[model samples]
Target: MNIIVISSPQQELNEASIIGALFEHGLEVFHLRKPTYSIYDTEALIQAIEPKFRDRVVLHHHYALAEKYNLRGIHFTGHYVKSHSDQLTNWYDKAKQQAMTVSGSKHQLKELETLEVPYNYVFLSPVFDSISKAGYKSNFADLKSIEKYKSATQLIALGGISLDKIDQVKRMGFDGAAVLGTVWEKPAQAIAVFMELKAAWEKKDQIF
Candidate 1:
């Protein structure tokens, strides 16, 4: 089970330092998602991170930075894909040519069926009640349906993921788990939570 961490939407104190620590502690993927950031602001944030770990970073916006920084991949939001339908093929082809992983977010299971291009993985969110978004309860109830879809493409469980919920995610047949609010809400204890989650994930793997 791959453990992915998403950056807080807004910058937090010592954000770069925390990111560097996450890499040192074996965080495999870090998604840089800042919806309101200008291109320059995004670039500055990336620059702030240690150069050695840049390749492990994924961009939610600023697709061009994937090449500029030799990033791990680029993640497309559902809205972005829908708005740029005509350019999806080109983006996919370019990402492949650059040998970068491609991923996206899908809120609905039905949307996964409609994806024309292959993604290395896709985030299926609100699997449980959201930690970051108020009042955003889990809408996922069909584990059987999720398992059925997992066979076609790698599905990563996102939203409200925590150490305790890791086992539940694995039992549901998800390929990976993504963390956001659980880490950011208490950045001071982020490392401890991350280590706990990682240990739980590895222990689960050992059993199954």
Candidate 2:
């Protein structure tokens, strides 16, 4: 199972340095999802990361940054999918040709149950109660009952993900897990926590 780490929506002290450490320590995908940051602020942060590791970064906003950097991928939140329907259709073909990882977000299983656009992967959230956002609880009554959707697009379990919960996520038929609070809740411990999560995720294949 893949271990995807998402950036904290709120900025962190020594954020860029911490991110650089993450990249150096085998973090494959880092979603840069700052919702309220300005273009200049985002650009400045990007510039701080090592150029070689920038390709592992995915932009959730200021997509134009992709044009300026060899970033890994671009993701569309559910809102983006709904608001920019035309843009998604036109961009997918081009994105495929460039070997870019394009993803989308969905809150409901019904959305993935349909023949949605082929995102490299899409995040299905609130698999467990969210630790990043207070009171943002899991939406499904029984996550164990979730059958994997049939489609080329991979499904990633998001919200409330942590090292111990990785097994539950994989058992739920998710392609992977995306984490936020587990890492950012204690910024000083981000790398330590990430290593533990990554190890757990990699070990899942040894099980059923």
Candidate 3:
């Protein structure tokens, strides 16, 4: 599974250092998910890292940043999809014209089931309770139900993902996993977590 890290500084993490670690660990897909941050803060972040990762990083909930920073694409939230689905479709169509992929979030299997449009991937969350978003729960048993939609959509599991859960996610047949707290707690430790997850995934693949 491909690993994606959400951008945030956990209690001990320095944002820049963590981001740098992600790159070092071969994490190519990053979601700049600072929803509560001001534009200036977000802009500064984009200015700092976007240049180095021009084609690899993805900004979440910020379409303007993508156009301004030469990012790969934007990861839309459920609110964005529901509120501006049509408008975003045009954006995606235009992006596709340029060979870019558009991704989104789907909290429930029904959300994934209801989509009549195209989204490159949908991040389904709470595969387990995560430190980043506490109280959220992941229904792992529902994976079998979600697999039915694989033909029409690519699912990326999010929320509380860590090295240990790699096998469970793979068995569920997810296309990828997006990590936040697991790597954000210590930027320097990010690569280690990533390496372990990769190694675990490799082992799982060998077993299956």
Give model 2's TM-score versus the native structure: 0.92
For model 1, what is the C-alpha lDDT against the true structure? 0.88
User: What ranges in model 1 sit over 4 Å off?
Assistant: 142-145, 205-208
Pairs in clash, predicted candidate 3:
126-138
Clashes of each: 0, 0, 1
Q: Candidate 2, clashing residue pairs?
A: none
What lDDT tens digits, residue by residue, belong to model 1 across residues 1-208?
A: 3899999999899999999999999998999999999999999999998899998999999889888998988988888888988987888898899999889998888887877689889999989899999999887865544676765568999999988899888888888899999889999988888888888777745544
lDDT of 1 at 24: 95
| Tens-digit lDDT track of model 3 for 89-146 | 7778767776666888877776776764687788987777776766777755446545
Off by over 4 Å in 3: 9-13, 139-145
Better of 1 and 3 by lDDT: 1
Give one digit per residue, the lDDT tens place, for model 2 in 24-117. 8889999999989999988988999999999898888877786578788788888777788888766666556667788988887888876347
- Scored by TM-score, the top model is 1
Error of 3 at 99 (Å): 2.3
For each candidate, what is the lDDT?
0.88, 0.84, 0.74
* TM-score list, all predictions: 0.95, 0.92, 0.87
